[model samples]
Target chain A: MELQKKIEILSAAAKYDVSCSSSGSSRKNKPGGVGNGHLSGICHSWSEDGRCISLLKILLTNDCIYNCAYCVNRSTNDIPRTALTPDEVADLTINFYRRNYIEGLFLSSAVYKTPDYTMELILGVIKKLREEYRFNGYIHVKAIPGADMKLISAAGAYADRMSVNIELPSSQGLRLLAPQKNKESIIKPMGLIRSGIQAKREERKLFRGAGSFVPAGQSTQLIVGATPDHDLNILKLSEGLYHRFNLKRVYYSAYVPVTTGPNLPAIVKPPLLREHRLYQADWLLRFYGFKADELLNDAHSDFDTELDPKSDWALRNLHLFPVEINRVDYSLLLRIPGVGVRSAQKIVAARRIGPLSYDNLKKMGIVLKRARYFITCQGKYYGEKSMNEHIVRYGLISGKPEIQDSTPQWEQISIFPLLPQLPPPEVRLATLTGEL
Target chain B: MIYLYDGSFEGLLTAIFEAYYRKENPEKILRNKALQQTLFEEYIHIPTDEIKADKVYDSIRSKISHQALQHAYYTYLSDFEDAGTWIYRYLQLGWKMGHKVDYHLADDRVLTVHNTSRKVFGESHLLLGLVRFKKLSSDLFYAPIEPAHNIVSLIAPHFSSRLADQNWIIHDVKRNMAALYNKVEWVITELDANPNLTVDEEEQAYQGLWKQYFESIAIRSRVNPDLQKRHMPRRYWKYLTEKQML
Candidate 1:
């Protein structure tokens, strides 16, 4: 087949797998290389739905023997399947990278005849991209389920990152939905990748590069709301995976229910917002120092759609909040509803100068609307008298600040506050206080 | 005391010398003594006095590097800061370095001015996308941007006849700054405030479509209001078509 036709089939097949972030890796351009990696996020383009569409993100081939029900490219689906030669794939990546259109490549494939056969093809592409083409750019490869361990190791050395999609949260779900896949095929390879990363880190104690195997580590995706798995169960699985494998990311795809078979539930629409809520929880776990059990339990199977996960956590654990901002620990400060990493850092920087009041928090860009109830800035309360769950939930949903803006200032709602003219210290206090 | 001079770079250069000599603050400068109707205060026209200006420039060069003096001059020319003449104080620190430590311009004061320089640099970048140029009948180009800062001078090089041989004008509606380029040379001006612009009507439609596409593509699943606020601030929304004017 012509290379263009092959590219179309493979790339279209790979579009469903949406875990394309080139941020974590910090590889620079070396001599005799075509591209560079950026710590600052860069994606070549975006899909119509504002999804990242950069990095010639394509399956090396869609020809698979596995019949996973959730996947469109499952074997029984009888979709048009094709595989690309390593030469064909490398040429396309080089061309795309040169045009400044794509920073790298994200290559995956369905099991083509055998898991070993598919992984070998993937490794060949990376080998050529590095050895022959001399391309020093970011490349993320999939660790196919049941793939041979040696081939997995070979692919890791050449790629900037490697990912193995845990795909199903539960072993029971995997069996019912994807019969061809099993627990051992997936988890064993993840263990292999984890050990490989650890070994590289240990070796780097003395030897410098020695090929940093998967500098971005491994990331997995979980399909939410597909089977009978609860949010707590899924989050538990994610927590275990993070601890077990040291995963850089765990992407939650709102399962697009595409089947009506007797075994499958009749899913009308995907739980997109649920996926978003999970992502919010995931951010809390990684950045905000939150544990999975803290946010969800057996009684609450779903995350609160009305409020974000962090806000929901704050409402439930009311005792923890109103923590003195001046005296609170870093980890506790991170749990405040509106305080993000940047705000936390700014608070640390600002407090070195003076004891911050409730007014000073907003100037540091804290979400005073939500955080005011949670943080005690030098013994001042900007929140309401009633901290009732329903009242707070209602406030979150209705877009009203729990504390009313009693002191109305012009710059608070102005189109352009004079940037050059510094607001008076009192106005700065009002800007800092969420109430005004 | 008030120090008014012929609005030249050197005239302001000399005024910086007198402001320090008199120890007058910015509030005193803006509240001109004669204009203030206060009997004890006085105003002075420093004039296009090359001797004083050259003396001030020479002393600055002797103390600070040429780069620091240039930055101070640009900051003075910008007229953004409350005290445009306070740059001389910074220049005094810069002159002691002369060359070596002048590049260590990342300190608090140097950073304050450098950061403002970046803000002006960013305004130029944003106006690149916001300024819609239209091809006029005589094969000239014209674009108008309503920027909050006087940033036309920074973006002049970007369009300088990339359509060369074609006359063009970039009118800044907010600060009333315009860059009139006639194929080769460019001149900056502050014309009378004219909100009535003559932008090509078709360019408006393309802009509408461009904005529509930008808005349509943002996924509702991840509509992070907090993140959005942290980025595109509410203040700059007036100039950007992506925002809805409430």
Candidate 2:
């Protein structure tokens, strides 16, 4: 096959994995190296899906031995099966990196022939890029499940970040959708990568010249809305992954239906809103110090489609509202509905100078519409309505229209014209019928 | 009183130094080319002096903080019309309040200078990734950009370290200048709008492959053009190889 044809097929197949972050690594360029990692990561472009195109995200090949029902590259699918040579992969990475087209390579592959064989091919490509090409840019490789410990560890020496797709939220979902794969095969590699990173940290502390082992750490992806898994379950699993494996991130891909099977849910569109809510909750967990149970529980297995996760949490715990902004702790400020990390920091810094009024809060970049419902400035309440749950919920939901007005006209007309503007009865009916 | 100086950063600093040295409060500080004369208004043209500029620079670094100096420098690089006045007012406040001026986010002068500096820093950071280099026939990679701010010099050191083994030139087409890197060091110099250079034979082929990969990677089910345009704005699409077809 031609090189362009190979890149098209491989990249299209690889898009389903959905981990495009080029961050968390600051690998410096050697004396004669060609690239260096930016600590905050740089995005080269944005794809049509509005996703950041950071790295050269392409599979080494799409030929798989395992037949997963949710995957586009299942063994049963009669798609074009092709693989790039190690030289081709390295050459593509260097040429693209030189042109400032990409940050580096994100090499993933299907289980072609065997797990070890696929991993070896990926390792060869990384070695060629690092050694021969002297490309010191960010690289994110996949640690093939069931691959040998030595092979996975060796691959980590060159890869800045590595990920093993959990494939499903639960082992039950894995068993139902992907019969060939087990949860043990996925968790085993994560455990190995975690220990390897720990060992490297110890070695680095003792000897400064010790080789780096996955300096950006490991992350995993879970396919959302594919199986009958609740958002609570997914959040809990992500919380566990973060705490146990010490993982950097857990990506939740709103399962796009590429193949149909009896086990898969037939959906008209990808669950993008749900995926977005999960990310919001994930951010709360990572930065805002919110637990999974605080966001979701058995009473609420899914997020409210109208309100964000933070707003929902705030509404549920109304006793915590009207906290005095001047005297509030930094942690409590973060729990406010509209006070983000930056705004909270600004409030903390600006308050040190003197007491702040609502106008000062606005100047500090706080979203006052939602924040006023939960905060008090100088012992004065700013919420338009009384501190009642029903009144606050109504005010929050009614505030959606003004936000929609800022969106482009076409998007408002196409997606959300009637949803936010409709009366309570029709909106409730839509919610009950799953139209929202 | 209105103080006029050349548009160089040193000239801006020298004007500020003259304001302090002469004990005259200027109504507006502007570049000589940007000055608009009004009847009965006093105008003083300050010559660029490196000694006076360095004295003010040392005082800012000593009295306020190094971060404050960086904010002053970045704010000057923004090339905004009122940037000179804002920096002057900001430094005036910094001299009084010490480093605590930055924490006064509610103050208009401090906030304006801080926000302008942040804007310049953000644009330079974005250009680090958005720059696209095409290999020329002379084996020197060349890129052209029309950035919203004067950020070519700010982003050059990053490329000098990143593509350290290769020679490259990043041409700022809007400002008619370029950062020429010769593997070891980089310097910003004036370059014409049209260089009349020829691309290497393999440049077109690599661009084609990149365009193909870009088109293939987007999921068809979640095609949000608004989001794409939000991240990579329409103004930057002209130079992006993948967006060339669009």
Using TM-score as the measure, which candidate wins? Answer: 2
lDDT tens digits by residue: candidate 1, A239-357? 88889899988999877655555556677667888888988888888888888999998888678888899998888988776788888888888888878897787677567656887
Error of 1 at B6 (Å): 15
Say which docking band candidate 1 falls in.
Answer: incorrect
lDDT of each model, Cα atoms only? 0.70, 0.92
**After TM-score superposition, what is the CA distance of residue A134 in candidate 1 from its true location, in Å?**
1.1
Candidate 1 global TM-score: 0.66
Per-prediction interface RMSD in Å: 10.2, 0.7
Q: Report how large a share of the reference interface contacts model 1 reproduces.
A: 0.02
- lDDT for A181 in candidate 2 is 92
Candidate 2 per-residue lDDT, tens place, A324-362, comes to: 999999999999998899999998989999999988888
What is the alpha-carbon lDDT of model 1 when measured against the actual structure?
Answer: 0.70
Clashes of each: 6, 0
